[model samples]
Target: MQTLHYLTLSVLIPPLLSFFAEPGALFFEGGATNVGMIMDWREMAGRPTVRGMQGEDRWNAYYGAWSGGKQLGSGWVEGMWDGRTDPMRGWVIAFSWMFASFADIYYLCILVRRPRLLLDFALTLGFSHIVLTTYYSASIPTSLFFWIVMFTWSATTVTIAEQICVKREMTEGLVISPPRDEVDDLEMGELLRRD
Candidate 1:
């Protein structure tokens, strides 16, 4: 369950955030740099350092900072401090949806116990992704359909897990073990335990 939650957030959150917030804003406005920060630290280290806004600055920050610049004709080290390229909205949506779908399928395989149930859920999930990929529509009805499938899958997994747990509990105390000592065959065919 926790795995499901984490996978959901990781696969959904970043692109959703990018929709509203500028990618640059997602990072510090005045970028900070330090041994740790330059080392890709997300938080302040022992010492605090501040970096100016990332863009086509004298330091040529944009080249490394913006995929826009990287994807365009800008050289690997050149900075595009002045402007941004196309957001590639369609590609972003497509990739995000596909990635989330893949993650869900992988996690479902791990969570579901019964092979038949797993196959059913997996087929449903694959179809849902196909609908999404084919339409690329965010209409309310489409969104609702996606959520419904997701919820149903979650419910089924929980129910199956509970059933398994209950079964294990019911049989736990009734488990039988073989005799610890060796057993020998008697003349009449009955087995006798040897001390």
Candidate 2:
């Protein structure tokens, strides 16, 4: 049950955050002919062309943004920083994924409250990323940059969560004392013996 909860959150939260952050990536653009229809809900709901892909082609490009895949372009470093191309959008998306990772880790720490389990949680998140990317793209993601980003996300999350949990544990002291009844009985016995 705990594993199910961890895996579900590990797979779901980051992508949900990405969707909220970059909703424009999910819509089909009609170019100059439909300049006024840019934010059409109908387009977003149906099989919208993502990054110039349509219908079945979109499946090959459905890499999750949380996994370092961009809807507008290739999420790989080579695609983002190609020698004559502007890389601003790619960098922004990457940072957003990192930010989402922070939130995900923080929430997990609060819920699980076990520092030792953080590594396992982080691994689950990384595995989910690989599975999602592979499933969506229909091929193994061989991009070095993608794997690096995924590793960075997992490492950073575990490190920060551990730090936070350790600090919290240190600050929260446990109080251990004898029962009130035992204390009273000892006090009465001492009084009787003295008299």
Candidate 3:
């Protein structure tokens, strides 16, 4: 049931958002701005503030090079630094994602009971969000790394979800079992004999 709820929330919510919000704007660009805490006055302002205006100009020039537009050339680093310093508003967005990820991990821990798989999924998902929220502050290489982590997290999470959903035996109560290795039994016997 927890697994089902997690899947329902994770799988359903994003597509629902896509119906209302502009696609890729929130995903690729710094458009999830309103999704988290509104720390800046500009963010709350109905109209664009100075930083928003400046950030948009900076964003265009930075994204311009990749889009085959004129490059920032020597001014690239300075432009990046300027964008990184503006406001810590991005952290609020990141924190919201982080909290959601944490809740998912907690539910998974109870649902799966498989430590290794759960750990891998949780860590990958956690790091992906961390990288994701840092988009405002990240450079080109770091942004590329974030994409890589996002892909890895997606693949790992899908696999784990599939395993949980398909296995009917794991759908209920604590699925505990003792270690099943003969080597461990032998080691235990040897220790008992020594004592």
Candidate 4:
């Protein structure tokens, strides 16, 4: 649920804003002005904020670039940073997606899984994807794919949490304890003994 809240609030907003904001691009070329706790304001120009639709950076990326580092467009993960500060936000976003994937798997491993928390995590993921989508419009298909995956994970987690909650309530209802009876008699007995 917390993750869902963040998904609805934090993670989702940036990308939605990026999509509409028109200026905040995701690729290296989409130079930006970031505002956050860790970030103040920056000016990144002539950098590859957005992946250009040309050259081997697109086609020969998978095969040729494996020797040193993965392509910069490798979703900013899988070896995409170039020792620049762009990773401040993109790297965190990429890492978040990675963390969310791990969490989704972890919840699946829970013995008595209540995956509602996964929804929040998935929401975080959705927003991360939204960030990617906002910047790399060309990468829409990939971002959209991940969004679908997040939704699937969310559905599973939410169902699990709901089940757990219902089961917990039922279990609490069935708890056995001494019944409440003869309260007035007990009170009268106590009062007479005190006198």
Positional deviation of residue 134's Cα in model 1 after best superposition, in angstroms: 1.9
lDDT tens readout by residue for model 4, 72-181: 33333445533233324443433334444434444443532443454554456556645644454433333343444456545654555556656665776796755556
Candidate 1: which stretches are off by over 4 Å?
1-112, 137-195
User: In terms of lDDT, which candidate is strongest?
Assistant: 2
* Deviation of model 2 at 98, angstroms: 0.8
Candidate 4's C-alpha runs over 4 A off are 1-63, 66-125, 133-138, 142-148, 162-178, 182-185
lDDT per residue, candidate 1, 40-87, as tens digits? 112111111223245556544433232223332232434432333223
Candidate 2, backbone clash total = 0
Q: Which ten residues in a row have the lowest lDDT in candidate 1?
A: 40-49
| Candidate lDDT (C-alpha), each | 0.40, 0.51, 0.41, 0.41
- TM of each candidate vs. truth: 0.27, 0.48, 0.29, 0.32
Tell how far residue 130 is off in model 2, in angstroms.
Answer: 1.0
Per-residue accuracy of model 2 over 1-195 as CA lDDT, tens digit each? 234433444454345434442333322122212311211212212222233235635335443232124333343344341112112323433554476577767676787678898888778766875675466545565655555666787888889988888877877765667999999999999999999
Model 2 / residue 27 / CA error / Å: 6.3
| lDDT per residue as tens, model 3, 103-195 | 564466567657456656566554544454345333222334334434454455555554664463455555665677976898899999999
Superposed model 3: Cα runs more than 4 Å off: 1-86, 126-195
* C-alpha-based local distance difference test score of model 3: 0.41
Model 2 is weakest, by summed lDDT over 10 consecutive residues, at 35-44
lDDT of 4 at 128: 65
**Best by TM-score, which number?**
2
